[model samples]
Target chain A: MALSFKPIKPLLHTGTNASSRWFSYIGLGIGVLLLLCSVQMFINIQQLLKEGSIRKDGFDFVSITKNITNETMGQPEKNLFHADEIDAVKKQPFIAGVSPLLANDFRVQLSAGNVLPFSTDMFLEALDNDFIDTLPPNFTWKEGDQHIPIILSSDFFEIYNIFAPGQGLPQLSKETAMGIPVQISCYGSNNTVTFSGRIVAFSDRVNSVLVPKNFLQWANKAFGNKERQDASRLFLKLKDVNDPQLVRYLDAQHYVINRDKTLLGRNKIVLQGIFSGLGIFGLLVVILALMLFSFYLQLVIARSRQNLELLLTLGYSPQWLGKNVSKQFVPVYIFIVLAALLCTQIMQWAFHHFVMFDRPELSSLVNWMVVLLAAALVLMAVVTNARLVKKLLHGLG
Target chain B: MKLEIKNLLPTYFEEERKSTSEIWGKERSFSNGDLVNIVAPSGTGKTSLVHFLYKMRESYTGSISYDGKPLKQFSREAIAALRKDQVSIILQDMRLFEAQTILENLEIKRQLSPYHPQERIIEMARQLGVDHRLNALAQNCSYGEQQRAVIIRALLQPFDVLLMDEPFSHLDNANAKKATALILEEAARRKALVIFAELEKADHFPATHLYHL
Candidate 1:
């Protein structure tokens, strides 16, 4: 019987190749997943920031005032911010725009129908209409309009609900509160004028009762006060309150931030820092995994060096042998990328459905960015593996 | 084809402290069908001579050529071609992969050129008394069995020259005779030159010439 020549399998290196190749895929898969999720989370946070609704504490705006020491306390007028100080604050690189907090020059009394039935003293604050994020429709007023639109602070209702229950007064919802008409009496310089005020919206950004800037300006002039409006509070539009230079500038000016607003601003920076830290950690894991993979490749190639030399002596070209060595890793690279992409997609679905149930606009799974990340990982694996294999083969050859 | 060695000297042999031998600096030549026995003592350069001829060691001075052409002038591709098609070697260590079976070790050579039929390989293995251990790992075989396996593997390639370094060092008389017969059969079929190194005279192996190292 005629027998055929048999081709031999590499028995010496097969055991190691089978056992070690999966670890590279697992490590790379984890690294790719971590990096993809972090980048996805970053995109989600950025989207929330853009929508301006996720910020429970306002970060896009800052409130500043002159430092009130014991000495300045005695002279209340001296603690107020001046024009040049406001200009100087505006000159700071972080400041995008600056608006002074305008106050009504008169005292006011409000009475609801059979509700309060008594005149309660009230003060009014105003800001530019463009600054309020939740400005309701028809929130502005003209001189001929009798009903003045008001944006009540959420804090005011929190305080009212505390006491209104004990007083036997019916608790008011925001809609019911908006419908209840109130009579306002403004008394300043012995001249009294009454205006009808109705609640239009509630504000979370600004912490005081808000009237339209146009209404405030009209009321201040009509109430018989004609003076250079000196503002005691300043609302600052900041590009980024986290900027160190802005912090340093504020510190040097002996100016104080509104404690509530400052805390919110700092929280944003801390949150962003945490996200960035996660991104860096993911990158480090990838680098470490890559190094480990390279080490494994080197070891496998080295262990088989004798066999490889024998093969070369048997007339096998280095390129042919190197290609055979590298071919084993190609499947691993493909599997890693596919597994990572699948994992990221699963995570995205879970996050979108469970974590972000209310926010449907955000992505639920692996987006374009995750795909790009997978592509990048595949490229890195191929290029790095090719280079290492070539170098090892060259050394052997 | 003819192989020529002229004014050949290993680099370390030129140093004053070492023993100098005439064969280290001698000119030698080999042609087709010439079975040249290199008989020498223990410290002679028998293994080095085999290594140099296989192009594994390049630390020797002087010229080595094939026919009339300098071997140094051959490109890497050409040298690889020559190794596959013209020259074959049975190393002193056998160089058989210990992890592979006997037949698989033979296939390493057989598959490269696909020169020998499997029937011929099986017949050769039977003649050497290793056909039953063909599927056994080379490392598990006895020394004589492995030596015979190496001889069979070396003959699987087509060659104009066969370099055997202590090829039968571990073989008994009967198995050595069998291996010598197989080597001579292949050499005569190809009309090839066989240069073999041995400590003592191999009267069983017919040789046309002999050189003392």
Candidate 2:
């Protein structure tokens, strides 16, 4: 009787094509899941750092110190400080800028027909019109010789759309951006500007609505400093880059608190502990899964019935057959691990949608996780392989 | 091992359909180039003698040795080394790797064997009358083809002895003659011994060297 061998494929080194496809799917699913987690982790790290820097120096290279009185749910009214006393610190040379901001907690009835109840502590920067890169509130427009346009932050864009379908724009027509101005009834005077004002760019920091300095001053003066102080706080920026001298000058002020630096360190430790705990759990699950699903060498040896028979008759000892079979499966496992990692990295990139965490520390985490997964895969493959051999060769009389 | 079965004795417990039976046996040193034919009409322990010599059936009271050293005294690695270096077996059932080609099957054998000339395979192919199908997969080859390939593989080994069990069941008369000639030639070339279990007439092999059980 004729013995027919398996057919050859266009690709060399073929075996159990169905099994290979199953592994491919496993690798694909793993890759996509890992990618999702990786991107989220990366972006989370970036967010952490960005928030840290803002908390430290504040956006616009400025910090606010205000004396305020507000009603709190307390037995006795809490002692409140005055803004005029806070403005007195403007004489401090390190304090390069001072714009006392008077803001009140209020619910906003958005034009898109949604009510935003003020929840989180929201702060706004009272800016001068000439601050470069400052965008207008709630919109965007292209730049030109003289006209400065407004741009909306990503958060507002996702939440609101008018005239444009998706409402995302680096470039929008003059008509759409400049056709209708948003009316502000803040100081009860109900000031209105040309709804056709130009929009330039969006604020990269908090999802805050940006308006011109005139608009901010007008709103605040009409509403009164409410806190009853001449100035909210003195904002400061260093006169020169890497000027530690300015840092020293600021440090000399006893009121200077390293709140930013301290919080970053504390949060980093806390977050690290949490992620490490979760990562350990994940690693355990992966190990258990691999152990159960291992491509056992005994199975390979058992399946290699014809091969062993031929090798034995070919003057090879039972021992020799055992070793040769072990050698053969090495390449297969290596191929699987490598293919898995490659597909994983690709899926991660796809899931990220090209938005990677540019911060240094989080990127390092990405690198570490990739290496970690690769190592784990290899270890799992080898351990299961060796155990299977010992079992298969048991009682080889 | 000069395993002299001095005053050899054994015991067995055999449970039958409704009763049980036991038997005793004797053994001697398996000689070199002894075309050993172990025969018995029924259960007379013919195949058992070979099995005990190889220590494959170990529920016995006979001693096995290699170059005067006790088989049990050696480490597993040492025994494996001895098996590879000193003895080769053409197993009862023909077993081969399905993944390898016929040539690759032989090549694996040649690789495991000590240095042979580069043309050793071609020479063996020509002698076995399988030179035309060197690249065919061993699995794809017919039983006769696989049998010849296996015999050639055994011949390629630089070992002291060969164990055979009905190894020529698949060959035709002409091919069988060629294979027998090649075996005898390779045995003399390597100064090696061969033990074959014959299921046919012993008259085909040299009369002087044949031993019947």
Candidate 3:
């Protein structure tokens, strides 16, 4: 006797006033989105800061200098490097390559005809070709080329702008400065050599004005006094910048790091603390939303006590009824989570477009890590609400 | 299937009343297809007896077993399964969902057991004289119509036992006769035992066994 009957529709008693708690759903959505954004922002910022601080390729190089100490107090000659100390630093396991700064013991003067008041004596330090971030294909120079390529510190532009306005001098942009050629005259003990110096690039890591190693070697042979060029500083390439052993060893050896290459450890710590605090606050909001949802469910069950008991008498298991009732809210959960994910993606786009505007390395779409985080949050909400519904049904029993 | 009851005493009963009562100590057993009419006056715990047997009220001191398993040992799911597949009850208040139509009330039970076809449910309603009102909401129906609808609902399930708590309290003699004939016909077809609690058995009522609680 197969019954020709329709499926059992959910009774009025099993339904809920979920629409009345629309604010809770919106609250949870915002909370979850904020949580995801904070975590993603923290990840992106950390990656940006880490990439800015340390490089693992050939670019991961830092310049190290021995501090001016009491032992070398007015002895300018002793301020130069000793070969044994350089060899000891090179022998360390972390150092990939160590090159000494080739400082020509000569006087160099720069003149820009009527653009400068007088010829200014400038200090020149040259490094290896591998240290240049973007070495142009034609960066090399010959002995008679009379044209020297120079790299200036990025900070030099900022300092120039600060003083030039007060000094009534025109400020030079990077492009403007690149085209300007100035006269350079070098003086040693017996001879004087003249060349034209052209600005090539600005350096964020290598702080000093840089020149070609070949030009320095040639100039040293022709005009330098010392037979062996003693370096005052050394460039070191390490595998990892955040390695604790390297920092400890540098501190022990009384070495000074380049001022521009400071890592963002304390800044990252403060940022993580703030973002984690925001994450905790968002979690609290989600928890409060869940509590309100549970209360709403409880009220529905309470008001329908008699109808539920009647259902129980009709051979309906409370678990089955509870599941049916609990499943009614699954769509709400999906809608809120999808809404939150959509908003999070929008926020991520805004973040990459505006906040991380200039940093191409930090700009990215949503990471897989954030998707997992959102999935975890949805699972937490569903499982928690299901358990609450089951507990309430159990209480009815 | 058989139900056995021995030395049952409900905690809701007063201590002095328990001392003066004999029904609390009496033992009884009912087999399949046995029609037992429990005759008791008002405040005699007839509804309590039905509630206890249905496993709704647990504050009792006794052993009630279905087939050799004690009722106290059944888990909630097991109890619900027994209620779903083995027994049907027409509660005293005719617990048809007031917010639903008469056909919807019957469908609630009919969906649980697919063997009861819609035609048969409608046929039962026709025999009970409530077929014309089946589309109306239960709350809007007259008391007798609602009572017949509950009777039809209880019969829609395939039960080895049917429990009725004063099922015909609101029905007139003619309607009670028609409702009883339909219940007995369905019970006979399924070989289901019938238990009904009433204030008194009518002269025209045909009962196989009568017990004064």
Candidate 4:
């Protein structure tokens, strides 16, 4: 048997069907609600994670370090450490590795007596030869060959051309701990420096330069130290990123993880647990209200379908009747999705502005979930409407 | 138009009344293009007779054979074709849709016959003087217009029998004569059976057969 096409029924006009109008309103409403819920969930989860991060890692111990005030490096005061001082610390149990450094800040004159200040603050840091055991590998310096060999920073080339205002030529302040001390004044006409450092290492960071302990002693002698420590500061290494030992180590080292301003201050485990209870209550309220609204709108749409019965009576089959009814649901579902998505955004804004003291960034996951939920509801509503239309048809027949 | 009804009976069922005998009758014969006047007031089961004759529907007992085969032997699609193409009806209440325009209402009638195009609709409207009110909505149209529109729609198809239930109840004397003449003319032209629940306004027929229920 072969199937033949039936004559086409005239298309319903745009905005003509009353049923479509009802479905559109309902679908739009449902969509907006879902979108809003998703956004809320996103913001809530993000806030939870942010607060959690503060609670977990907000208290790291930092040992007070000082010694090599050698200014060859911009912050040579921060470089030198004492291994003997580290041994005196009660946090010796948590010790990882101790590294000491020497630094200098001075000017160097190139060929032709054109003396210029070397603005580069070079640092000579010495590791325990096992700094890798404590810090990650990518952060450690690997250099080959000693004298005449240098590890220049990425900004080393750039710093050479920098000019100081109101100064015609660069000048050097020769700091001497033991080596030859000579003061040089640069006249801009004859001062030109050449780049001769080996590119053993480079970093995008321009703050500090690195060298071995052997060179550090030379630099310390060249630039002179304000004060030298008895031993290096301790750099404790833990098996995991988070360890309770960090808190005790900070106490023994007289270090502190100040949290009165950061996220850690506001978060107490008990307080968050209470907030979670409130959030759950809020969720239940939303579901009940939204589901009721959805069911109400559905019934209203069902009543409008009674007017379409004459078509069915006039030889239109049930299946075609469903298609006719589906037109009503399409616009409604579209409206619902859009409205719900929009509502979610509004709610998220409101949550940040009014509800939460700390405005957490919205979660992408929650946003998408809201979208997905609203879409699913719209689809379900359409199918429900069609089924209702069918039941009505059977009743009329 | 030809039909065959064999041992037909109709019943109305209700929870309170249980079941009541409606039309306990049977028919077996072949009549072609006969102008029939089934003169039963309302609810004398004239619709039941026609319904059973065209095809035995729900709550109706006995099989109606169309052109010699048992109606039960026919598939749903086949019965649908018989109703849509072979047999057409003008419902008693006019059944004009409230949602459609006057032109649309008639167009639905025209659509019953796939072979007849829109040109035939213009022709039918012209003959019935409904061309002037082509754009008016259906419910807004006068009762007489609805009656004429329905009859014209039934005529649009090459129906074997045209079943009309008081299709001209609303037409006045002059328009009633015109509508009757037009309906009879089209029925005679096609040599189709025009079965109508006759009204006082129905024009006199010289040689037409009458069934006074």
Task: Give lDDT tens digits, candidate 1, residues A1-397.
Answer: 2222224336326456644556765777788778877777776665554554334334477677788898888784687777887788778777888888888887777777466644568888899876776799878888878888889888897787778878766688888988888887778786887878888888877777888888888888877467536677888777655553566577788888855544434555566677778878877877877787887888877888888777767665566566667766788788877887888788878888888785757766567876887888788888888888878877874
Summed over model 1, clashes come to: 1
Each model's Cα RMSD = 8.3, 17.1, 9.6, 15.8
Relative to the true structure, how large is the alpha-carbon lDDT of every model?
0.77, 0.49, 0.78, 0.51
Residue A307 C-alpha lDDT in model 1: 82
Tens digit of per-residue lDDT, candidate 2, span A313-390: 333455544444444546655665566566655544554445644433333233555657666656665666555654
* Per-residue alpha-carbon lDDT of candidate 2 for residues B1-213, written as tens digits (9 for 90 to 100): 233332233335232311221123334465455444443233444345445544445565646665667655756556556555666666545666655687776666666654465488778888888888789987788898888888877766676666666667788888888887887777667656666666554445552344443
- Give candidate 3's error at residue B129 in angstroms: 1.1
Per-residue CA lDDT of model 3 for A144-199, tens digit only, reads: 88889888788876787678777776788989878878778899888887898888
Candidate that would win on TM-score: 3
Provide the interface RMSD of candidate 4 in angstroms, 1 decimal place. 6.2
Considering the two chains of model 3, state its CAPRI-style docking category: acceptable
Ranking by DockQ: 3, 1, 2, 4
Cα lDDT tens digits for candidate 4, A234-270? 4333222133344445445444334332233233333
lDDT of 4: 0.51
Q: Estimate each model's TM-score.
A: 0.62, 0.50, 0.69, 0.49
Q: State which candidate has the highest lDDT.
A: 3
Model 4 TM-score, 2 decimals: 0.49
lDDT string for model 1 (B17-59, tens) is 1235435666788899999888877867788777777777777
